[model samples]
Target chain A: MTTQQLYEQIQQKQSFLCIGLDTDMNRIPEHLLQTEDPIFEFNKAIIDATHDLAVSYKPNTAFYEAHGLKGWHSLEKTINYLNQKHPEVFTIADAKRGDIGNTSAMYAKAFLQDMSFDSVTVAPYMGKDSVSPFLAVKNKFTILLALTSNEGAFDFQTQQVGNEELYKKVIKTSQTWESSENLMYVVGATKAEFFKEIREITPHSFLLVPGVGAQGGSLQDVCKYGMNDKVGLLVNSSRGIIYASQGEDFAPAARAAAQKLQQQMAKLLHV
Target chain B: MTTQQLYEQIQQKQSFLCIGLDTDMNRIPEHLLQTEDPIFEFNKAIIDATHDLAVSYKPNTAFYEAHGLKGWHSLEKTINYLNQKHPEVFTIADAKRGDIGNTSAMYAKAFLQDMSFDSVTVAPYMGKDSVSPFLAVKNKFTILLALTSNEGAFDFQTQQVGNEELYKKVIKTSQTWESSENLMYVVGATKAEFFKEIREITPHSFLLVPGVGAQGGSLQDVCKYGMNDKVGLLVNSSRGIIYASQGEDFAPAARAAAQKLQQQMAKLLHV
Candidate 1:
């Protein structure tokens, strides 16, 4: 999906909410286990109920990968289902993958092309060659990890590279790469104040902001600093939205959690 | 497998050569595509031929993942086959996976615990929490990416963070994490001079050195600085060994290539 198309979806839905499909097998409702693919079933239900409220769905590959072959199969089904059912909704494969040049191309093919995700999250540790492959894939977005929400973000990301922090350096250096126009960034919403500096680096590129729900970042703070004129902020809420309830009404509950965030976003967007 | 067991195997085999199973379908022989599972079939042939020469097999996950479900299944079969048939040979799932704490735990479980790799490569961009979970896995090595072989390594890795380079800070900070004893690292053999500084920081920790054959790094230079008393280096050569012959003689040809590297390692060890 193009950035303009994504923005149109946000306007149409009056929301920039990206519901995270971090479907944990143990955390899902127990009755779903009786189904053929519990993970897929849960994901499908959540996507079905909440697709209208959210502009995008970010599925973390690690959650599915935890189950091995069956898990990978579930991931396959989830992506296929999304493409088939809700092609308009932006799909982000939150697979933090990066490697050497050739290997990185394989990963780009795996997630962006084969899996048919609109975008895939990439680690920037390996630098230009490792990440450029993903950018090379036309019409697909490479959401490079900049300032992660995790406590571990402080380890090296916040450290000084020269005069600036490493994440700032990452954002600045990434723009100089080939086809960097396809580049978006993963900036933690928890670091709302830093969003101002980040936006200054790349004013127009969309930022996939995580840490809005369970991880605890104020929506207003993120929007106040991070939101572009096009509302280029996909504030993701995973655990807080998906695991809202473990009862039979889990899907509706998921929708309710998502609705709450979407309502707040709608208000912010003045829609 | 324990670090001592890995060292013992290296001593017994007189080699620390890690054969990288970066099995690209396009690069593999045409005849193998006729087989039901060409990736697995090719991997089986290569493993059966050169298992004795190479102390470890580092299967880059990108190759399998590119094929989607079938690719994942091939990966599953390949790892299972290695565990069942060649248990003594140290296995490295060159997945380069690291996420937030919980997600990283899932990845650690996926590769180290469930997939049953002796070790799994992890990216350190996310920092301490993202990596410590991999270390928490008992008897499994978490090979952290310290300095990579690719040209992009100069982008952020070689950049000065404080008094030392970012890779050095990574190596230093990593040693302070919990279960740091199980932590090994990836230092590219391409930069052999950097190996001395890496070894200074991680004296006993095994370094999974890539960029040896296809990418061109001298074995002699790597050992001169990187090797410890236990011969702590798993020098990986992927394309040079695996793609030696794309004909029916591929297996034997792979064996020859591995034998050449093993012989060099043996000479280095004075075996």
Candidate 2:
């Protein structure tokens, strides 16, 4: 999906919420285990319940990959379901993947071409060639990791790089690469204060914020500092919404959590 | 495999060679594509031919992932084949993966527990929580990206971070994580001079060195600065060795390429 299209979706829904499908089989309702694919079934219901409230859905590949082939199949099914049912909603394959030039091209093909995700999160440690292949794919977004929500984000991301922070250099230098206009970034909601510094560098680019709800990032702080004219922010909530209630009413419960966030986002947007 | 077991294999074979199984189906011999599983077949032939010469085999996951589900199946078969036939040979899943705490644990389980790789390369962009779970696994290694070989490495890695370079900070910071002993690092061969600084911080840890032949880094230069008493380097050669020929002679050609590197490594080891 194009940036304009994503922005439009936010306007239409009054929410820039990106619900994370970090589904764990063990954490889901006990009844769902009887199904053919429990993970897919759970995701299907959640997507059905909260599709309108959330503008995007990000399925972190690690959750699926942990289950091996069966998990991968669930991921394939989940993305396929989303594309068929709600083409208007953006999809993100939050697989933090990046490699050498040729290898990265294969990754770009795997997530962006074969499975058809609108964006795939990429790590910038390998620099240009590793990330360029993903950016090279037309109409697809390469959401590069900047300041992640995890405790590990401080290890290197916030360190001084010449005059600016390392992540600032990441945002600045990546802009010069080919087709960088298609680029977006993953900036953790936990570091809401950093959003001011981040916006000074790339004011127009969209930021995928992942720390809200469970990770203790306030939605209001993120919007207060990170928002742009286009409402350029995708606030993601995973465990907080999806696992709100593990009973058979899991889907409706998820909708409730998402609706609360959507209401908050609407107020922030004055929609 | 433990670091000691890897050092022993290098000593027993008189080579610290890591042949990358970057097998591309389109690039393999035409005759092989007629088989039930061309990728697995190609990898089997290459591994069988060069098992004695090379101490480790690094199958870059990106190559297999690009092929989709069938590609993932091929990867499963390839790793299973390595574990069964050549149990002595160390395996590295060159999948540069990292994420949040729980998500990273799932990734650790995928590569280390389910797939049974001795090591998996991880990007350090996410920091301690992203890396700690990988280290938590018993006898497994987490090879963190330090100084990559690509031109993009200079983009963020070489930049100053307070008193040290970003890559240097990466090395130092990761050392304080949970199982620092289980940690190895990816210090690309192209930046051989950086090894002097890297070794100062990580004197005993194994370093997986890529970019020897195909990417144009001198084996001699890498060995001169990077080697410890254990010959702490797994110098990988992918295209220069794996895709040595496009005909039925591919297996033998791969063996010959691996053998040539083994000879140079043997000389370096004074064996």
Candidate 3:
């Protein structure tokens, strides 16, 4: 989906929530475990319940990967389900994949061409060649790891390299690359206070902000400083929604959790 | 495997070769395409041919992930094959996964606990919390991306934040963490000259070096500066080895490529 499509969905749903499918097989209800693919069964139900309420579904690849081959099959089934049934919901592979040129090219082909995720998170550690491979595909995005929410984010990310913080410099310098027009970034909701500074660097690009619900980040605070005119924020909540309950009512609990956020998002969008 | 184990492997095999199983489906022989899972078929043949000749097998997760379910299954089968068949061969899931405490714990469980890979490549972008989670696991190594081979690695990695290069500070500070003994680093072969400085900070730790063949890095130069007394270098050749041939003789061709590197590594170890 295009950024415009994502923007339109946000406007239509009166929500800016991106339901993170950080699906854990062991965490899900035991009933799901009986299914052929428990992760897929849970995801299908969550997507079915929360599709209209969410602008996107961000599946952190680590979750599927944890279960081995079965997990990957679940991911494929879930993505295929989304494409077939709920095309309006954007998809983000919360996979921080970045390497050198040829490797990155294969990575780009893997996620963008093969799996067909709308966007994939990329680490900027290796710089433009690593990130640019993802941008080579049309309409897809390379969401660079800018200002993260984790504690260690303060290590080198916020440190002053020359004149500006390293994260800021990454954003500013990355704009020079080709296909950077399609570039978004991962600016954690915990770092919402720095959203203004982030905006000064890449005002128009979207930010895939995690660390909201279970991580104790405030939605209002994120919207206060992070939201653009285009509603360029995919605020993600994974554990808080997907694993809200470990019972058979997990899907409803998932819905309720997503609904509470969507309701808050509705108010934020002034629905 | 520990650095000690890796060192012994280098001595036993008379090589320091780490053949990267970056199995791109598009690049593999067309005959394998007839199979249900071409990636695994190609990898099985390659591993069968070169397992004893080489010490390590590094599977770049992107190549497996690109094919989605099939890719992941291939990864599982490949690793299981190694574990069951050649238990002595060191395995690495070159996934480059790292996050916050809770998330990193999940990632560790995914790649290390749940899956049977010996190590997982982690991006230290989030600093201590993100990286520490990987180290928390016993008997598993966290191969941190220290200095990569790509053109854009200089964008931030080589920048002097205070008195030291960002990569150096990361290496130095990483020593403060628990299970620092298991921490290996990825210092690209192209940056062979930086080995002197890197070794000064991390003398005992293993370095998983890439960028030898397809990226124009010299084996002689890397050994001259990078090799420790333990022969502590897991020099990776991905595309150069795996995609050595596109014909039915791909496995033999890969064996030849691996043999060439193994011979060079034997010399490097002796010197």
Off by over 4 Å in 3: B30-37
Give the DockQ (C-alpha) for candidate 1: 0.92
Predicted structure 3: lDDT: 0.86
Which residue pairs in model 3 clash with each other? Answer: A110-B66, A152-B126
Error of 3 at B190 (Å): 0.8
Report clash pairs, candidate 2.
A152-B127, A152-B128
Q: Which one wins on lDDT?
A: 1
Candidate 1 lDDT for residue B23: 96
Per-residue C-alpha lDDT of model 2 across residues B58-118, encoded as one tens digit per residue = 9999888887778888989999999999999999999999999899999999999999999
Which ten residues in a row are the worst by lDDT in model 3 chain A? Answer: A64-73
lDDT per prediction? 0.93, 0.92, 0.86
lDDT of 3 by residue, A175-195 (tens): 999988899988888877899
Tens digit of lDDT per residue, candidate 1, span B1-271? 8889998999898889999999999988998999999999999999999988988998999999999889999999999999999999999999999999999999999999898999999999999999988999888899999999999999999999988999999999999999999888999989999998888888999999999977889999999999899888899999999999999999999999999999999999973
What is candidate 1's TM-score for chain A?
A: 0.99
